[model samples]
Target: MKEESSVSRLQIMSVMGLSKQRNYLLTQYLQAIQLPRGFGGDLVFEFQVSQGRVRHLVLDEQASSLKEQTVMELIRRSLLAWLPEESRSNR
Candidate 1:
């Protein structure tokens, strides 16, 4: 399992290299998962579906830096705040 801090909004966007067409899909399902302990930071949840079965997994974020975690939180909040504006403009 990987740490949640190992991944970021910018990193996912970088990995997927989503175009304008797919950007809406990402924004549509933006989510946040927290660790069961509910002590420090967020957790990462991953789901996979195949020809056989689907699996659910949660990632840890124990050693993440304060700066590392906050940046993503800030970005997430900013995106959430901007979503309404984006929708209106897209119409």
Candidate 2:
């Protein structure tokens, strides 16, 4: 379990790095949202946006019963709501 967790963390970082490398827009978007808590935990949520689309938000860890798809949909709706018209319409 601990090994899987470590691998997941590394994978997330690699994905984030690739996202930043492949898409400057995504990198910039991610920068807008702040992570109040560092990644990896059960009690905190990390925020990010990519390709002008918000990424899935994980309020709970993988061990929790929360659905990942639902969480992502919620984040998408939320990002749309929070973003200004110019930002949304332009994409």
Per-residue lDDT tens digits for candidate 1, residues 5-75, read 43332223231333454455445535332212223333342433222222332233453333355444554
In order of appearance, the predictions have TM-scores of 0.27, 0.26
Model 2 stretches astray by more than 4 angstroms: 1-43, 60-83
Q: Pick the candidate with the highest TM-score.
A: 1
Off by over 4 Å in 1: 1-67, 84-86
What's the lDDT for all of these models?
A: 0.37, 0.42
lDDT per residue (tens digit) for residues 1-91 in model 2: 3544222111122234334433444434434553333234322345465555446655545543434454445444544444433446777
lDDT of the structure predicted as candidate 2: 0.42
> Candidate 1: minimum summed lDDT over ten consecutive residues — where?
49-58
